[model samples]
Target: MKPHRHSLYRTFANAAAGVVHAFKTERNMKIHAAAALMVFIAAALLQLDLIRWLFLLLAVGLVFTAELINTAIEAVVDLVSPQVHPYARIAKDTAAGAVLVAAIVAVGIGIGVFYEPIRGWIGSLL
Candidate 1:
């Protein structure tokens, strides 16, 4: 008998659960979650233009997605190799580096989107 396909809601629920799992299982994911929350809050507080908000959200999502993938890669690598191996180390490091690159790009995007607004706020406060 063929397995039943999940409904749309079930798929979305599973995806959300996986995201939560990623955040719980990965330290970097937790950090990314905190940063993403801050960016989201700042965006709302600053009342960013639609385009700017979209860009910020996209960047934040990219970083989070990259981190989740990195965590998955590391888990698979560890499961396959359990023992320390140079190739396994390389695989894990490469996955981590990809996440780092995504994070850096996100940070740059966040700065570009928020710098002027933040500076103006600081200026007003001084």
Candidate 2:
């Protein structure tokens, strides 16, 4: 079979469609998106420096990337094994585990980035 090719615009559009689909269908995706929004709002309110912003952005990006990958893996596993199968269960579980790990790492980065600023803000209130 000849390899199908897509224009760059079409490629990005397709990717965007996948993101929309995930956001619409997956509860976890919505939760992650909400968390990201809150993080961005906090970053703005705190007036994070460039380095801190970069760290938060990277952490958030890592989480969304992991979630997207997990969504894709779950879809493929479901497609291949519509029936319950041991390997399919393992694949889905492992992908979920990866998402959990990414979220935990992001939380750690968030605390590290915001701790000093928040502490100072609280201190000033006293």
Candidate 3:
């Protein structure tokens, strides 16, 4: 069936449904969401500068995008290859690797953003 052109609100609602579906179906997506929330809280508490906040946003967005793409890849792979196969394995593994790399990069960025404030806080407590 040809797709219908959705109204603006419906389009937004559909996008929100996709996000909810991902969070429901994908453990990694849920974890990324939690991490993102924590980062936002930290950024707020620390009153992170604009540059740092931008970096945090970029890192979080990358992870979210990577995870969504990974989910789509896995769903397509499963639909196309219902049985175990080497090529299917490769596709899923590669998609997972993309998420892993994004998560690692986000962690590195988080450290860069939080290190100084955290260290200073620790020093004050000592």
Candidate 1 lDDT over 1-126, as tens digits, reads 999999999999999998889978888888898998989999999888999999998998899888888888988998999999999999999999999999999999999999999999899999
Using TM-score as the measure, which candidate wins? Answer: 2
Residue-level lDDT of model 3, residues 1-126, one tens digit each, is 988899999999998888889999998888899989999998998888899999999999999999998998999999999999999999999999999999999999999999998898789899
- Candidate 3 stretches with Cα past 4 Å from truth are 1-9
- Candidate 2 per-residue lDDT over residues 1-126, each given as its tens digit: 988999999999999999999899999999999999999999999999999999999998998899999999999999999999999999999999999999999999999999999999999999
Q: What are the per-model C-alpha RMSD values against the true structure?
A: 2.1, 0.8, 2.0
lDDT of 3 at 111: 97
RMSD of 3: 2.0
Worst 10 residues of 2 by lDDT: 59-68
Error at 73, model 3, angstroms: 0.5
Candidate 3's displacement at residue 72, Å, is 0.4
List the global CA lDDT of all models.
0.92, 0.96, 0.93
Clash number by candidate, in order? 0, 0, 0
TM-score of each: 0.87, 0.97, 0.87
The order by descending lDDT is: 2, 3, 1
* TM-score comparison, 2 vs 3, better candidate: 2
